[model samples]
Target chain A: MFDVSRVQKELTECNRDKAISGVSIALYEGGSDLSHLRGTITGPVSTPYEGGTFLIDIQLPSGYPFEPPKMQFITKVWHPNISSQNGAICLDILKDQWSPALTLKTALVSLQALLSAPEPDDPQDAVVAKQYLQEYPTFVATARYWTEAFARTSVAIEEKVRRLVEMGFPEDLVKSTLDSVNGDENLALEKLCSS
Target chain B: MAPVPASVARQAELLKQDGNTYFKKERLGAAIDAYTEAITLCPDVAVYWTNRALCYMRRKEWNKVEEDCKKALQLDSHSVKAHYMLGHALLERQDYAGGIKELEKALDLGRGANPASYMVEDIWQVLAKAKYLEWEDLSSKHIYRMHKLMEACERALTSFYTIEDSQVQNDCEEIASERLQQLEFLKDVFGKAEQDDQPKEVPDYLCCQITLDIFRDPVITPSGITYERAVILDHLRKVGKFDPVTREPLEQHQLVPNLAIKEAVQAFLDKHGWAYKMS
Candidate 1:
């Protein structure tokens, strides 16, 4: 069984300095299960991933703290060490190098650090890694584009939905379309038009 | 008949004596009541609070004991009884680090006050328990810190064993020995975790494709892919009943323990224990 008390303590500790740490954790919306959580981490400054707010799905195993937390990116991003297709991170701390002392906040901080420093040699996405190593400028441009295209869109959902509705699409349809395309206004409009 | 007038201090003294009498008679509630009355009469006296705390301790009321002890300490910081009681209360509450600090302070004050009156051996025994408990809490967190705590436990154990008090010696020895066994188990687990901090390349075949860690108990799936038994079992049970690498449909029974690979991993671990930390 999961140690609910420890998980509760970790959640409190992580959220206590959410503003300062730029990382916060909340209970996964559907249920009261403390084992599943939703985490948010602001991208580190002075990096291609900066100004992007990343959402992460966190699942705690029964042996959590003893066992490493299962974390994957819920928000799309472009990084050599992170799978562009599935968001599987290639950080050691998420796997065999995980220590029980590490909390959710620290793990998210590490993810932010990973954004700043991509280890292309130990790549999760081979194509991205190749691009990163062989076409440094192009890789930076593509990563910056992905962040702008995917990451920032979540913040403009209200505006996007309003604009789509003003363009004669139903409010509910606009809302669902925006969510389906991860809050991308242009894509949601195209999806609405196509439907 | 002569009318006798008692001063507030004298009245408090009389009440304290009554509390002591009740305490010796094992009437803890009555003892507490008497101590409360004494405190009401002499709020500035630290002894009343310490005496009440002792009564609370007898009743196994750790929080009450802690409160009274804090009150006593506030009145007179040098009160050894207050420190001792507070340490005992904190220990009972499993605040080992805080308890240890308070006990250490009591020991220091006890030394200055009167060495003969100090329960030196008992304090050492409690200190050892606190150190061992602290190590237990830290073992899962950080291997290096756990190693340091283990060393602290060892030092405390050594000191505990040297105390001349024959009354607690046997009990302390038993506890110390048990703690040592626990420490050995933790050492085995943490020794490997500490190695993770250092960069060491393992032979590729030694690592499980699923976990990317050296195998503890290697097992082969029907798909001909080898993995650590625990990792594969976890994947099968939770994630999916398929090969993590190949995505081939699989089941638990399809897993056969690869003894040859297991033996190799064992030999490797036996040779270099530090490389086997991911338990």
Candidate 2:
């Protein structure tokens, strides 16, 4: 479980700050006992994601404070740091910027800033990152496309992987085999599981 | 003992070679003795540490493996095999994150970048057996056999499954039963290998991609060893042996890491903000 007070304090601070806009936030803790901790962020006026109500999922690590909590995008966006398949956000602060001095409000502000101007050089999504670096326009267009496709009602990759699995193959084989085949979900499970 | 002869270095090298030979032959006990003797003769050499670490690894003495690997690194931090063995030792100890770091270093130092194809068949067998165990009941061994038979039938749903004909189910059941028995015997003989041996099935291409991914860093090739930094290049060239029709290196068909997986893995490092180096 996380320090709920700290998270709440951060949420309140972000809400009060007008600059931090256009993002929705939600917090979850205690893996099995998942009670909706909180969620709220408005879309920013500036940036490509402007007018977009981006949903953010903040999951506290089993050991919070000592370790950093997880922050992912629940709303689909074409950011270099977020996976298009799943709204997995790649943030340095969330992972490495874990100073006790930094609060959830500060993290939210950072994420909002990231939306305005993504660090193309240091991207979480390599494909997007690479394209962003090499061909900036294409990356932006793709990001926009993905945002339109996924951000409207963002879904998780696990659901997609599960859907593939339900087609008759074992989950373990599906994942392992899909990885080797490099995202080809239609691969025959028999060939993958064969000795 | 008055003065160390020039031949002493040569003698130590010879002993070290002998230890490596034994290590390769899987005569671990002898390899250990030979490496020990070489170390006793010349305590400063790095290869001696490497040779002894291999022996320790064969014996499953992970602590000693780590100790020897560290010693080798201390003597020569650039030694690729030293880092590779260190990664293996760390992995055996279930220090996955640490092990991964060491392995990344090993590739950076020019050791084999990816898990070799040699590891695939064995790893698969192990995974299959584990899956078998999981699917099999704790209550009855015979019932377990029956379940495995059903599982094999389901596997036959695709053309990739080799078993054919009307009696295929019974034949598969018989083959699976015998193999499971043999596997149990092998486990007893080897004194418990890892549960899922399935060769990490890390594709040769993935290994190449990972190698390219790690090598793409500017810091990797600072001292004019840029192209040769990732050991995967050599392994990739060697993958020619696997192809009979080509009869030459499969240089063209190889998949280089496109910018995405590279950035993702790098982001993983950057996001973790974890610091790591070759040593």
Candidate closest to the true structure, highest TM-score = 1
Off by over 4 Å in 1: A29-31, A165-173, A190-195, B1-279
Q: Per-residue lDDT tens digits of candidate 2, residues B1-279?
A: 354466887888888888879878899998888888888888778889887987787788989999999998988997777777787777677666677577666644442224442222222222223323333322245445545754564454433334444436555577667655755564454333322222222222222222222223221221212221223233344322221112233342343434443454455434222112111
Cα misplacement distance, residue A75 of candidate 2 (Å): 49
Return the top candidate by lDDT. 1
What is the two-chain DockQ of model 1? Answer: 0.04
Residue by residue across A1-195, what tens digits does model 1's lDDT show? 755655776677689889899889998755788889988888788888888888898999887655779999988989998999998889998897664435677888999889989999899999999999999999989988888877787666687778888999999888888877778777878889989
Q: Pick by DockQ: which candidate is best? A: 1
Q: For all the models shown, what interface RMSD does each have? A: 10.5, 21.1
Error of 1 at B102 (Å): 23
| Per-model TM-score on C-alpha atoms | 0.41, 0.30
CA lDDT of A87 in candidate 2? Answer: 70
